[model samples]
Target chain A: MANHAISACAPDASIESYIRHYAQCIDISLKQALASSNAHPKLLEAMEYSLMAGGKRLRPILMIAAAESLGAELERIMPVACAVEMIHSYSLVHDDLPAMDDDDYRRGKLTNHKVYGEAMAILAGDGLLTHAFYMATLAAGSDAVSLQRLMLVIREMAALAGIAGMVAGQAADMEGEQGITSLEQLESIHLRKTGDLIVFALRAGGRLSGASEAQLKALESYGYGIGLAFQIQDDILDITGDPAKTGKAANSDERAGKVTYPYFLGMDESRRKMHELTESAKQAVQQAGLPDPQRLLQLADYLMQRDR
Target chain B: MANHAISACAPDASIESYIRHYAQCIDISLKQALASSNAHPKLLEAMEYSLMAGGKRLRPILMIAAAESLGAELERIMPVACAVEMIHSYSLVHDDLPAMDDDDYRRGKLTNHKVYGEAMAILAGDGLLTHAFYMATLAAGSDAVSLQRLMLVIREMAALAGIAGMVAGQAADMEGEQGITSLEQLESIHLRKTGDLIVFALRAGGRLSGASEAQLKALESYGYGIGLAFQIQDDILDITGDPAKTGKAANSDERAGKVTYPYFLGMDESRRKMHELTESAKQAVQQAGLPDPQRLLQLADYLMQRDR
Candidate 1:
């Protein structure tokens, strides 16, 4: 359900097509939702800044991939994909808030507050996050299982985003901001703060399409691997990757003295671990025997390739 | 399903017992929810300060009253009553933030920030508010109509609390904080900021137990007048109520230049309006001719009569 796919690449399908379709569905729906909040110009402005910000649309891609694996139709799958992205975007916005990470820039643009001020930025995150559930309900339509799945995913995301997941992770983050922490502590913090939502997104997509329990289990394995690998690559890139590609300050994590995988395991070991994690994720996807696993495998590769 | 049967003068339930029962339900559930955030000590403390601070549980009381009107069992109604209070408490914490109202004291104790700092206070509010829906879902059970009804109230509350309702109202309040305005502007602000939630609690309770359309319509009418009256009385209380009972500094609204009902309408007229509104609400309840309008009518009277 969440594993990386490992089939030979489709002869005709391009990543561009996948990107364009996912983007169009999400952008249109997201803007419509943002517009509904238009009466509060400041809040809407801040939301637009974050929601429309450039990214690979990775979380939504994972959703679309999972849905496609189940032979679900485009219309049936689009809403869940968009909803997952909304949650992701919201997490980024709040994580970057003044009280949290407080980065003034993200993806080469002024961060939400840098563009819209702190209060509006806060409200924008709140609005987008809450609206994600609102969007998910539309997908439920007449399907009882879909409704329950959507509700469960929303509940899971909420838990991850609130005290149990992101916030607790953040509390540890802020506490550890002063210095390096144990590798176990850092991993625990990252697993919830950053990893939880991504895993939830993958499994939620599988749930949406009624993927078999066997397939779903594989997806969870894939999700776990990719999620941890994603963090490792992020740790590696923070110190080594080109800032221009990353859209963040070079060595920002190092200067912040953040306890990343690289900091705990050292650069060499961390890089090896990242590759191992990616391989593990790809293997999970292969074992799942998804009809087509190329994009999922390519996505794992893409995670390692990304500078940011 | 929220209306309670309070008989200050009679047997099965007295005002003291009714208020105590509702208050205990709200307090105990709130404390449990707050305890979950104990992983973050400061957050737990911040939530405790505002959540546990003494204030008459008016919203819960309203919810119970409406539930009683629809003949729902008391134990079954407790969760929603607690959820409504959480919504109310979250709004209060956010409102008292430095970026919002910037208050230093509430209930004559240090505000959330004074005790726990700003970021923790913000997170605490976010945690409590997000948890409200989770609590709501528990009480809603598996009944489709019940779930939908609960979601309807929640969506409305979210709107009110977000940019559209409470946040919008709060923005208007913030904008109006330093300015002078007429009675209409003051009334409008309070209507959304406070009145909307109260309306939801009352009507939602009625709807929860499947109240008649005619009965609901009457409840709405009762809600409308009293909602306004409640705020007007609040404004009046700021000037005249016992500070200890009010849990805020005497004349605090005036001191903040809050452009409250009393200030806008003038003291004498505001008091007169409150009485008129209460009477109208009482009359609406009376006209509805339910099996038990005693609680509703008495609540109307009590809303006007309570100086603190």
Candidate 2:
């Protein structure tokens, strides 16, 4: 029934198809813009290496999907989609910097600063982040309403990516590794560090589409639920996920001594929470009266089930 | 004659008055928006400390003056002006970070990392630099010309502030400490690093003012000349500047084995070159037919002659 409702509204487009299309929108611009600062061939090559490496492209797709449900034009959402992905790419690059996470191999590829050398990696991240706005400016070209929407979207991205959001979470994550973490502390750390950006991604898309006030409010609630659901699923997968499909070591998170939902709650309890969060997310979307909830339902299911 | 030109324009606004007027034009809206994102007040405070610190406000004032010259409204220039200042502030903060110059002070005050700790300082700089564009969007509103101008101004600023410009220059400077730089190499680094930003500042103002294409060309020339002149003055001051006036150690450049024009050409030749650059800059503005070149002329002369 859920799939029937979703398909009726966004008929003929598979969730996978939409995600692939969104990724294409992001990669075309991301690769072109960060490629050159002053015709430096090597820096572009390195940025391409990290950026092209297959991560989920989850944030960008979320932004686009949310925007679509609100009736935003494709052009309007592309920039915000690209911007969120760029921010994600930048975080990954910096996390691999010498002063930070430092282990280097990410998504089963050599880390950015490691492959490109430390200095180029740092500049690559800076260039990518700066260029994201250059891309987002495209959205500003549409209308004041659109531009205002873009501004809010980017503000949310920057805040999540900056001190209060990603950076703070990263700091807390770093601190947690040196000691044991209480469940509450761990949740607090993850909320800002990871959850916030994902939430922004969902809500920004809705904003771009000019979703009705009621719709926007509901999407926000949906975003909060799914953002946590996504993280919780990752925690579960870290413990029991298939390495072949996930392309990562199943127990890597545990080995790292990192705090996770699974670490705080037993695996069984974590599973229960994930299911509840996914249901909660679906309810929020339903409450919003989305014309098509099929893909969104699929997304929620994927979030609750996926190992990676 | 100089006094007559100065008097012919509006009465002498003290530096404080000039700086404050520029400040009034800078948007606080973006800052207000980000205020609530704080997980800790210290990070925000550290960011504000450097961002809000008293300086000549040279870059922003240039942008505003350019806007005014073109008959562009104050509202139109505010975002770009703030963006430029944010870039400047980030550079200062990072330049004082542990991996870079490692100074504990800047502008005669405790440096950002000093007050906030290294990690927070780094994050603060990154945050301000990235958030600059979000602020620019708010200022841009719906004017395509203004928006286009914003992009142009931002691209130029990025080129100046990034690896091809200031940051890259810093890299070469630190790396070349053990080596003797030929005059050409020293000039290249300075032109790209320090000169790039100053030139960008001038161009930003010119673009915002809706200057004619020919006028922009002329302003470019103005930027190049003043930028070089400004650096030469610094080289001269490093040798004989009052430590009190500079709020820095006398002859610190020499002690640090920095590459400087004066270091290469000696005091007499450097002064002669600075005079030539200053003359060219003045001629460029004059040829542009600005009704009031007095402030700009005074500005050029002040930069070339400042003891600090």
Candidate 3:
């Protein structure tokens, strides 16, 4: 399952092909990165287990598409794109740990902890997170990407993925369980938790491509819109998505008493908000004057209509 | 104990003074880095709890000393120095988790997990690790350090501190619990676990300072010698040192049925190896033609005699 197509397509074969093309490249780059690690074989196996357990590959795709849209060469930015996915994978691995979400399965397969045991799973997560930086730093080795720009990318990754961004969101999400009072609170949490990384992927791609200040801001706007919309869809899917397709138990969020978009806004309102954000995301990219904004525009639409 | 003197000083007052001066600078830089993070209040507290619970500040001090010895500006490399310490702290935090070493105390204070709970502690460690890259990448923002050099530093960091180095060591250490190992095997494990980071610190410092390849090689040689010697001392200390001074239970390694240098080589031989390695480290620096080798030489001697 991890080696096969991750997304259930949205009827547009071209967009599906586009994603497949980029994801395959990402998968290869990811494997190469792991191969060069020279890590303990058991540890390497644990890392590969979770990292290869594919999902949408959304983050890396977003990064690649954003970079390509700005005329950045595929080979130059692929490392950073894959690095984002590594960060995402590590978070998922840690989230599935017994102390956190304690999920038994992810993507229709055993979670890293389920397969590797707790200690190795923890180290695996640590390995992925640490190596993500290594992958991104590799971009610096290339003359095409300036050191200052690569530094910005590394700083952005660290800032957005660290305590100030995704980690903070996880912390808030956990604390909010004691009391989730309103939609605003939930949105606040998701913004840092989910939105920041999306923002990082888009901005890092743009930055690596030498995008202007105005263009970088535009990517941030698009990232925020899609980031929120994506999470809302995830919440909606928890209730409506099929277990076989989504690779998750039905209504797992509700079962865990997790506060989500639907929990606060209701399904009807949640769907409306998701569409609104998706449209805004498309508009942000369309208006950004990028040489190739078609893929990003389509991605927003595809994300809006995704079933899994 | 965490805030006060971390080292039981050597007989030479000058070496002690050198360490104190550098340690104070490292403390301030580390605080400043964390202060600017703007993480969640609670998360910040958790991170601060572990970070501020200081030990010898050995890694950062080593980085700073190595850089300073080569005429690199302290301000230029201080961020990198603090970054290494953050990585070390994160390793300790994660290592002390119930799923890992399950320790209750460190540096004579409650462990991060003991105080912050398992989940928060995990994030805290994650936070520190991610932030370390942010701090190291900051060196690129300075004009004093060239991007190419800084790029090498970042690459070395991710390589040695990530899966290829520290994480590999940690994985081996955990797996080694299954059986008593030979001296060569024990040394191999400690070399990756401890020596790699030490090597990274020295080489990164050298790279940032525009050290020649021969100089960097010398640093690596010095790092390997002291790294093994340091671990040997730790094992010997487990049996002979005071809990009050060491801040750890006496003979905890033996209690855990862990293999150590002394376990294979015996106390006298272990002590002999430590002194031999220390002398070799001192000789490496003395022969490197560093403009200032006094501090590094003294440090090797200081580390050889540290009680904690």
Candidate 4:
């Protein structure tokens, strides 16, 4: 029944195929990036373990798709795409630490800290974060993007992932452990935590491809909508997802007293809200007059209908 | 007696004056950099607490001196200088975490983990590291350094600080905690752990100042010599310096069963090796034919004679 519902929502399966295509390309690039790193063997192993752990590759795909929408070549943006994934992977590594979320498993495998020990995991996170920037800077050598544009992309990536954006969300999530006061607070936390990086991915891709202000704004809205929808889906999955499929124990959020959309708005309302966001994200893409909004629109629908 | 001996070694005293001058400039720039950051208040506070904490600020000072040797303006390299110090500061914060060094005090003040708790300290460290690159990228906006030069510096900074250098050393040190078998291993650890960033400081400064290949190589040799000497001094200080002065417990390394220069070569030989390295470092600078090598030469001698 769930499969049927998803198929009903995503009438075009081409987006799913494209995601697989992009993921394969990104996997190859990510491997190439780490294989050349002469880090300590143990550290390298830990970093590889987490980075190669199965993921949706959503951020990087969004970046590539955004750039493609602007008629930019994939080769030019591949480094940046890989970089965003690295940032995401590093965040997951740190977020799984004993000092942080203390998760034992992720994606049905032992977390980085569990496998490599707390200290190595921390360094792995640090290493990945630093290497992400190193990878982004490599994009500067490409003739496709101007140095000034690359600088803006680099600066925005740092700001979005640093204290002001992702770090701020992490800090708030920690502080809010006492108790989340309102829906506004929860939304704000997710907006900065999840939305900022998503926005960075899309905007960076657009800017690299010489996006006009209006086009950049459209991508931002699309990114913002999808980011919120993604988080909402995560919240929904915590309540309804299978441990085998989601690679995490269901209801863990509720057990941990974590605030989520379903917790505040109830399951039905949360589902409605998520679909609404996804609908708006698709509309934003369609209205942007991009040369290729089809891929982005299909991606939004595909994400909205995902089981995990 | 120690003060008198230092004065005898550094007869000019002008380098000490220069250190003080450069340190003041760095402090102000660092403060301004953080003041405008819109990071979460607690995260910002944690970053500010450690960044503003008193220390030698040697890395940034070295950067400034290297740039000054090539007649570069202070305003142009100040961002990179501050960026290096930020990197140094972040490493200290993370190194003091309970999972790593378990250090409670640094520079006579409570460690970040000790004051802000472990999780915040971790985030604070991440914030600083990311912001360091952000700070470095700001230099791209400066007219003094070309975009290509700035890219090289940023890449080097990340490499030296990331997996291949500082992180590699840290991993090796942790893995060797059971027992460091040889002096060579100890030297290698310190060379990457402490040396790479120092080398980065000098090279980046020189590069930003449009240095010739020979001048850059000279700075590399000078940096390596001082870097080794610096670690040897740290080992000696761990054994002999006052806790009040050094802001660390004497003989802590010995207590931790960590290997050191003195452990391998004995006190007399360690002292001799340190002085020999410093002498070579001074000679490297003097022979570099830089427009102004006096500051670099004097600083090397002054560092060699320091008690803490």
Best by lDDT: 4
Ten-residue region with minimum lDDT total, candidate 1 chain A: A1-10
Tens digits of per-residue lDDT for model 1 on A1-308?
11122122243667656656665556676666667654456556666788888766777777777766666554655555666677678777767877777788788788887876666666666666556655554555444455455566656655666666666666666666766458887887777677766776777777777777788777777777888889888878778888777766678877875668877788999989888989998998788867766777877887776666
Each model's C-alpha lDDT? 0.70, 0.69, 0.85, 0.86
- Per-residue lDDT of model 2, residues A1-308, tens digit only: 01111221244677667666656656665555554435344555666677788877888777767766655556656666777787788778877766667676887888986776665666567656665655665566544455456656666666667767776776666556667558778777767677777877887778777777788777767777787777888777777888877767878887876778877888889888878988988898887877756667777786676656
In model 1 chain B, where is the ten-residue run with the lowest total lDDT?
Answer: B1-10
What's the true lDDT of residue B82 in model 1? 72
**How many steric clashes does model 4 contain?**
0
lDDT of 3 by residue, B145-254 (tens): 48878877887888888787899888888888787458877888888888999898898888888799999998999999989988988998899998888877899988
Candidate 4 TM-score, true structure as reference: 0.94
- The best-first sequence of candidates by lDDT reads 4, 3, 1, 2
How does chain A of every candidate compare to the true chain A by TM-score? Answer: 0.88, 0.88, 0.93, 0.93
Enumerate the chain B TM-scores of all models: 0.88, 0.86, 0.93, 0.93
Which is the better candidate, 2 or 4, if ranked by TM-score? 4
The candidate, 2 or 4, that scores higher on lDDT is: 4
RMSD of each: 4.6, 5.9, 4.1, 5.9
lDDT of 4: 0.86
lDDT of 1 at A266: 88
Q: Write the per-residue lDDT of candidate 1 for residues B1-308, one digit (tens) a residue.
A: 22332222233676656667667666776676556543456555666678799867888888778877666655555666677787788788878777677788876778887777676777777766666655665555454555556555555555545656665666566656666457777777777678777877787677776777788778877887898988888888889888778876788776765677766668999889988999988888788757777788878877777767
User: What is the Å distance of residue A155 in model 1 from its true position?
Assistant: 2.1
Separate DockQ for every predicted complex:
0.36, 0.30, 0.62, 0.55
Candidate 1 segments whose C-alpha is farther than 4 A from its true place: A1-12, A37-39, A74-83, A212-217, A288-294, B1-11, B34-42, B74-77, B178-180, B212-218, B286-291
For model 3 the TM-score comes to 0.94
- Best first by TM-score, ranked: 3, 4, 1, 2
